[model samples]
Each structure stands twice: as structure tokens, then as C-alpha cells.
Target: MSHANAALTPRHRLRIARLIVDEGWTVVAAAHMFNVSWPTANRWAQRYAAMGVAGMDDRSSRPHRSPNKTDQQLVRKIVHLRWKKRLGPVAIGGKLGLSASTVHAVLVRCRLNKLHHVDVRTGEVIRRYEHATPGAMIHVDVKKLGKIPDGGGSRYVGRQQGNLNIRATAGRPKNNKRGRVAGITFVHTVIDDHSRIAYAEVHANETADTAVGVLRRAVSWFAARGVTVERVLSDNGPAYVSHLWRDACNELGIKPKRTRPYRPQTNGKIERFHRTLADGWAFGKFYNTDSARNNALPGWLHEYNHHRPHTAIGNRPPMSRLTNVPGQYN
Candidate 1:
């Protein structure tokens, strides 16, 4: 393929070459006529003189020799390890006594970087599918976040403060006979498979009613952005399998689908989003308290949906895929 930002097509280059080589125009005059640099025009003219018309065609820019490139034998060994052991870059690197980055580069070159790209059982490249349109299938899941203690969580604060906060809250909750676990905040998350647009809410629990309510709101959220929800995909969690969830889907006229048991990969999109949520929002920065952390979700969510570039969608924000989003203009 021609470079996306190429200044001239092969036809235009051929014209430049003809002007310089056939018409006997000066390289400077030809470059000025074609609005190209002198070297560009001269190079094409030289190519045409040497190889005739075929030389005007686009050629690969890759160097003929890459001295630093990994050896062919090493590349084959890396590929063999991927197929025979189904190991990730880190694991493969550990076994081969190579740097993880070197192994990772080989894996990327071989197109076996993502686990889903390779079948688990056969170690063969697998074809993965996605919904072709927005809202064709939205993934729903609950991410349980450890609520920051009143004085901040261990992530930001010291473990001593964490234990103190735990001990301080031990007698507060009625069900906690042993107060080892401080508390958990359920973050109901919904993500579109096509655009990777996401919606999330922090709640007290992950009950059937709460899940249904989140689903209802999430549908409305997408609708406001001009996307109609056709289906919902989720794991076999207690809330997802409940009658309330089924009834809610039925009432909303949306199809509900569940991943096969023990196969979290079936709902991989949301799972990956949850990891991003953890890194970008929940643990992105310091929080004086859980309430402070909760207060930051909307702002981060706004940035994620409207400004943050998603690699799956070619480095554009998810909002780029939607219509009539009021925030889109802003």
C-alpha cells in the first residue's frame, strides 16, 4: 500500500519522471512543477532512466539489510515455543533466559502477542470476532474495588494505616465477625464491544436489583448517545443469572447472553476494561477517603469516554464512534 500521507501517487511520480527524463526538463523545474523537493524529482527521474516506466511505481521503504534484527533461528525458536508451550512473552523469556522485551518484540512480529489470538487447546492462531456495529453487544460486569479507608487505602497510605482503618471499622458493619476485610465497593460496568464505550457506577452491593438497575441506566446512557442496545453479554455471576436480570432484559427488549462457565475470556472486553479502570481511576492517584475516590469517577469516566484514545478503535476516543453526544462537541 502507498504511504497514507504520500505527496504523490505512482501516476503523478510517473508524470514527474516523464517531465525530467523524456521532456529534458531540469530536476529543479520538474520538482517545482510537481510541488516536490529536488531530490524527490531527481530520484524518480533516475529510476525511470534506469528501469523505464516500472521504476515510477511505489517501492517498499524497508531497508534491504537490518543488521540488528533477531536471527532467523532465534525467531523460529520463539514461534515454536509459542505453539508448543502457549507461553506469554514473560514466561517464554524466563525459559529461554532472554529479556522480556526481546521475547515480546518477537511475539508481536509473529502476531501471537494476545492470548485470544491463539487457541488455548491447540496453540493455533484463532480468529476472534467483534460486533460490527455500536451497541450490537455490550458487555456487563461488576468490578469489586476495595473501598479506600476513611484515611486512605494501603495503596496510597502505609499498611499500618490500612490495618488501623480496618481495626477502626471492625465494629461498624453488622456482618463482620472478623474485620480483616475493610469493605468493598461494587462498580457496575458496561462496555460496548464495537466502540469500547463504557459506563460504570459505584454501588453498595452487586445484588440482582442493583445489576438490573445499572443495566437499565446503561441502556439509557447509550441511547442518549444515539446507540440502541441490542444485546447484553455477561459472566455467570449471581446477579447475572438471577430472575431479576432475565426479567429486566425481557422488559427492556434486549437479548441477554452469558459466557460459558469458567471461561472469563468470553467476556474479555469488560475484564480488560476493569483492569484499565483500576489503573486509571481507582488507583490512579491519592485519595483522602473512599468518598474522595468515588467523587473522581465521573471526571475520569468523562476523560475515558471523550478524550482517552483506545487502541482497539485506532487510537480514537470511544465517543468518536457515537452520534449526537453533547460532550462530543466539547
Candidate 2:
């Protein structure tokens, strides 16, 4: 493409060049007529004389050669570290005794500047795909968050006080000799692949029974929004692979699918939703009590579904995908 400051487009260049070469117009006259420099007009005429019409097009600004560029062997090493080791520029620089900026420039040239651009499973560029319609397939996952003590966690109160609350309110009594385990809330989520609409429930455990119950509610919730789930996708977690989960899917008349072992990317939608859940709701606000935070989830989820703009779906709220629903609009 021509730069903004260029005097003429390829069409105009061809016109001016033909005027000078074929029409026998002087370079200075063609330059004056086209409101360009004499040298620019003369250059185009010369290129046309040698290379024909192709010479009138834009040319790459990159230099033909760079003597100081990294050697091919070193370039191969840099690329190897990026794909094999998944190291960042700074780490690669440190390991190879090169400057981080140098390493970064190389990464940019190789189109490996962002780690997400590479697929860990195939060592190739990441190719993203989505199912055709809402509920054609839904991804399921669980996010385990540390439950704030009754008073609060360190984010709001002081860290020392937070530790005190944890010890005082431990699932095990303080008098027990065994080490205490603080509370953990498992947030089970189901997200539609095509629309990015999601539903979730916070539970005390990630047991198969809890997972199955959450799936049932999620299916009903999506049905209310005018989407009937056809299939469910989840990781091969114990809860997801259990007999209870299988029977639940059978009763719901939905097919169940699992990602390949150790490959979470096969179920990337719900994995991404868990990150969004943590950032936008779970830790977005400081809560004085766990109960208060739990109560806030439904409100946040409503906003996410009805109001919040989601980039993956053109910055409209997830409810936009359910336009056929009676109460879809504000």
C-alpha cells in the first residue's frame, strides 16, 4: 500500500509513467502535471521502461539485506526456545546471553511475540473455532476460590487479621492437632460456545453430585433464555467423569463430551470464562463477608448476561444472541 504522503496511487503512477514513456512527455512536465517531484516522476518512468506495469506498484520498504541481523543458527535457536521452552523474550535473552530487546525484535519478526499465538498441543499457530449456535455445545468447568472468612479476607481487612479469622473459623476446630484447612468455594460454570452466555453456581465441594446438580440448573436456565443445550463439553476431572454425571446427562437428553487428557485447550471456552469470572466478579470487589459476596454473584451474572459488553460477541451483551426471547432488551 502507498503511504499517506505519497504523491500518486498506482493508477495515477501508471498514467504518469505512460505519459512520460509512451506519450514522450518530458519528466518535468509530467511531474508538474501530477503535482509530484521531478525525480519521483522520472523514477516511475525508468521503472516502467525496465519492469513494465508491475513497477508502478508499491514496493516493500524493508532493506534487501542486513549484515548485522542475527545469524540463521541463532535465529533457529531463538525460535526453538519460543516453541519448545515457551520462554519470553527476557528469559530467552538471559539464557542465550543476548539483550532482551534483541530477542524481542527477533520474536516479532518470527510472529511469535505473544505466547498465545502458538498452540501448545501442536506447536503451530493457534486456530480458534466456535460451534454454530447457542447451546449447540456448551463448555463446563469449575473454578476454586478461597472463601473469605465471615468478617473479611486480607483484600479488605489487614493481612494479620485475615490470618486470625482463618485460624478462628477453620473447617477444623482450632483445638485439633491436624493442620487446619480454610474454606474453598467451587464455582461451577457452563458457557455456550457460540454466544458466550454463561451460568454458574458457587458450591462447597466439586463432588460429582454437586456438578450434576449444577448442570441440571444450567440447562434449565439456558432453556428459559430460549436456548436448548444439545451437548456438554468438560475436562476429564473426577467429578465430570463420574457415573452420576453420566446419568445426569442421559436424563437431560444431552450428549456429553470430554477434552483429551491433560489438554484443557480442547475445552477452551469455559476455561476462558473462569478467568473472566474471577476478574469481573469473584475478586472485582472487596466483600466484608463471604455470604455477601455469594449473594452478589447473581446480580453480577445478570449484568453480564443482559448489560455488560462482551468483546468476543461484537461487544454486545450475551443476551443479544437470544433475540427471539420475549424479554431480551433493556
Candidate 3:
């Protein structure tokens, strides 16, 4: 197929080739008319003579056959062994009397290279889900981050300084400790189930009162943008089960739902958002103090909601999926 920016479309190639073969136009003249090279014109003409117009289309760059490629039966065995035992390439190779590199190549070709794709027990795929509409459900989760040390920690300085910073603050009270520094910051995130639009805040603790407060702010934030929170989903954390949290949900007319006791995937949307938050903001950069990291959350949240493209939603910003209701940051 012709690529978007290709020098010549299939039609152009066919036209040039036809002019040379049927109309007896010289290859050089045809090449000049099409603004292509002599070899290009010659190849197209030969292809057309051999296979007609169809030959003007692009062909696979890959060879017709790879003689050195591992046999299909052998490849299947490697895949079967991988799925059955969840073994690494080296282990599978050893069992099958093949080189580790060869087993890896087979696994790569079969798209069975990633451990996450295979279930350890059943070897079945782990599928994902998304709600149908914005605000149909909101995934709420909390991520605890160790605060950076004063004047920056190991990431900014050296490991020795980081340890010294931690030891220096060991005498401080529990509430005062910063992440890695001495205490921790609990990041409460509420992400729209469909659009993946997220609202996040860093708090001192993940107490029931803190969760309730965060939920109130998140609901108000969504309400301002015209998305009513129908339901809220979260893990079965103590804060989530508290009467304060439930009362807060009732006040907003949002039903509270919890994931199964040990299954966090039921609230996977916010869980995934937490990972993004960590990579893009929390630990994304070095901060001199806990306050600096906390300060970065607002800006990063804005970027995540209004600028960062979400892969699950067709690579458009989460705000784009908000439909008629544009986000506040938008």
C-alpha cells in the first residue's frame, strides 16, 4: 500500500508504467514526467509487464521465506512450554535443547515475550475494561509516596546523603516524616471511568476524613464541568469502608462500590492512573522538599487531564472524551 507521504501512489506508478509499455514512451521521459529516478521507472515497467497493474502496488520488504528461521512446530513447542510453565527463554531453551537466543526469537515472533500477557495459572489473557460514558463511574485510589529529603535526596545528590538525611530526621515525630526524607505524602486520585480524566491531591494521611475531603473536592470538580458522579469505585481500604466516606458519597448522590477483598483490578482505572502519576510527577523529578513535590501535583494534574494523550481513548487528551462537558482545565 502507498504510505501517506510516499513519493508515488500506486496509481501514479501504474500510469508511468503504462505510458512506457503501452504508449512506447521512453523510460527516461516517463521518469522525468513523474519526477522519479530511472531505476524506479524501469522497475515499475518491468513489474507491470510481468503482473499488470497489480504489480505497481507495494510489496512486502520481508523476504518470501526465512530459511534460517526456527521451524513452526519448534516455535509452537516453545510457546506451549512458556504458557504451560511460564518459563523464561533460557529455561525453555534448556528444556528443548535450543539456544536461549533462538527460544527468545521464537517467543518474540509469537508475541508471547511479555510476562504480563500470560496468566500464571491458566495462561489466559488478562483483559481490561472501561465504562461507556463519562462519569458513569469514578475510580478512587490512594498512593503513598516517601517525601524527598531537604536540599534534594539521593536522586539529586548521592545515596550517602539520602541515608544521612533519613537518619537526621529519625528523631522527628511520625506525622512530620517526609517520603524517603522522613515523612510520606498520600496522593488521593479520582479518575473518570471512561475518559480517564483525573483529579489528584497530596495529603498528609489516607485517613477516612482525608478520603472524604478528597472525594468532596473531586465531586465538585466534576460537577463544575457538568459530569455527575453516578458511582464511585475503590479498593476495600479501611478509609473507603468508613462511615465518613460513605456519608460523603451519599451527600453527592454517588453510590460507593468496592473491589473484591483481594482483587484490586476492579478499581484498575485509578490504579493505572497512579502509575502514570508516579512516573510523570511524583518520582518523575527531583524535589528539594516535600512541599515542592506537593506543589508539582496541580500542574501535572492539569497536564494529565487536558494535555497528555491517553492510549485507551485513541491517543487524545482525556478532556477530549468529556464530550459536551469540557473539563475546567480545558
Candidate 4:
């Protein structure tokens, strides 16, 4: 196949081949006309002779057969072991006397890389789920991040310096056991089910009141941009089940929903957002102080909503999918 920026297309190849074969032009003349090598022109001419115009079309460069490829018999055995035993790659490799990577590669080629892709009992494909409307449902969740030391965290300062910062902030206890605990920050996140536009805030705790407050602000933010929160989905955390959270949702006329017990994937959107949040913001840079990290959230949030492209949204920012409101946070 031609490269993304290839100078000649299949049509050009066909034309060059016809010039050499039908017009009786020499290979050198055809190559000179197309600004390509004589061998390139000759190959096309040979293809035309063997299969006519269709043969001149671009074809994959991959070899038709790989002699060194794993035998199909061995691949079938690997698949059977995965289905029968549900063993992980390393364990399967150990049983078969193959390297873990080799087993994994075999599984990938056979479409068994993830257990979820196959039914444990029947080995059938599991259907995936998706919502169709922006803000028809919203995912709400909390991710707990360890607070940075007062001055800076170990990420910025050396481990020893970080220990000193912790000691300075917590002070040595009277019993001389250890410094006070470094508090945790709960990041409350809400994302649209369809567009995946997300809102997040760092708070001292993930109490019911804090969750309700964050939801309120998130609703307002989405409302300004034309999305009305119809349903709020979360895990069965105490904060989500609390009467305070329910009352707040009732006031906003939004339904509150929870994921099945121990099934975090029911609220998978926010969970995935947490991963992106960690990679892109929370641990993406070194900050001298926690306040610096906190201050950076708004800019990152703006970028997430208005600038950063999302793969699921066809590489456009989530704001592009929003309707009935201004396209940006502004």
C-alpha cells in the first residue's frame, strides 16, 4: 500500500503500467514520465501482464505467508487453555513452557487479550454499552489523592527534604511517635455520559455535603452550557446514598443512581476520567506546593472541556459535542 504521503496513487500506477504495456513505451520512458525508478515501472508492467488493470492497484506490502509465525496448532492450544482454565498470560506461559510475552501475543492474535472480551463459561463476545445523549446521564465519583507536603512533595524535593517538610507541617508529637498524618484530598468528578465533558474539584473530604455541593456546582456549570443533569450515576458510597445527597438531587430535579455493588465499571466514565486526571494533571507536573497543584486544576479543566481532544469523540474536544449553550467554558 502507498504511504500516507506517497507521490503516486493506484490510479497513477495504473496509468504508468498502461503506458509501458499497452502504449509499447519502454520501462525507462514510463519511469521518467512518472518520476519513479525503472524497476517500479517494470513491476507495474509485470502486474498488468499477469492480471490486467486490477493488478496495477496498490497491494499490501506484507508477505503473503510468514514461515517463522507460530503454528496454528500451538495457537489453538493456547486459546483452549485460556478458555478452559481462565489462566493469565504468565501462568499459561509457565504451563506451556513459552515466554509470557509469546503467550500474550498469541492470545492477542486470537482476540483473547482481555477476559472481559470472552465469556468465562461459554467464551462468547460480551456486548459493550454506550449512552446516546449528552447529559442524559452523568457519572459522579471521587478519587482520593495524597496531599503534597506543606512546602512541596517528594516529586519536587528529595525524599529527605519531603520528610523535613512533613515534619515541619505536622510537628513532632508529644509522645514522639511520628508526625501527623498527611491529609488526603478527595477530587469530586462529574462527566457527561455521551460527550465525556468532565468537571472536577479538589476538596478536603468526600462527605455527603461535599458531594452534594460539588454536584450542585457541576449541574450549574453544565446548565449554563445547555446540558441539564437528568440523572446522576455513582457508586454505592455512603456519601452517594446519604439523605443529604438525595435531597440535593431532588432539589435540582435530577435523579440519583448508583452502580451495582462492587461493580465500579457501571460508573466507568468517571473512573476513566480519574486515570486521565492523574496522568494529565495531578501527577503530570512537579509543584512546589499543594496550592500550586490546586490552582492548576481550573486550567486543566478548561483544556479538558474546551481544548484537549478526546479519542471517543472523534478527536474533538468534548465541548464540540455540547449543544444549546456556548461552545466553551467562557
> Best candidate, TM-score-wise?
2
Model 4: per-residue Cα lDDT over 191-298, one tens digit each: 999989989989988999899999999999888788878999999999999999999999999998888898675686788899999999999998766778999999
Whole-structure CA lDDT of model 2: 0.86
Q: Each candidate: what lDDT? A: 0.86, 0.86, 0.84, 0.84
Cα lDDT tens digits, model 3, 265-285, are: 667677778889889997798
- For candidate 1, lDDT tens digit of each residue in 103-180? 999989877777776768767666567999998999999999876767766676778787677667533454543554
Angstrom error of the Cα, residue 235, model 1: value is: 0.5
TM-score of each: 0.65, 0.76, 0.67, 0.67
Q: How many backbone clashes does candidate 1 have?
A: 0
Where is model 2 more than 4 Å wrong at Cα? 1-45, 48-58, 61-78, 87-109, 120-122, 168-181, 327-330
User: In model 3, which regions exceed 4 Å deviation?
Assistant: 1-81, 89-116, 119-122, 167-171, 174-181, 326-330
**Candidate 2 at residue 123, lDDT?**
69
Compared with the true structure, model 3 gives a TM-score of 0.67
Error of 4 at 162 (Å): 1.0
Candidate 2: which pairs clash? none
Where does candidate 4 stray beyond 4 Å?
A: 1-110, 113-126, 170-181
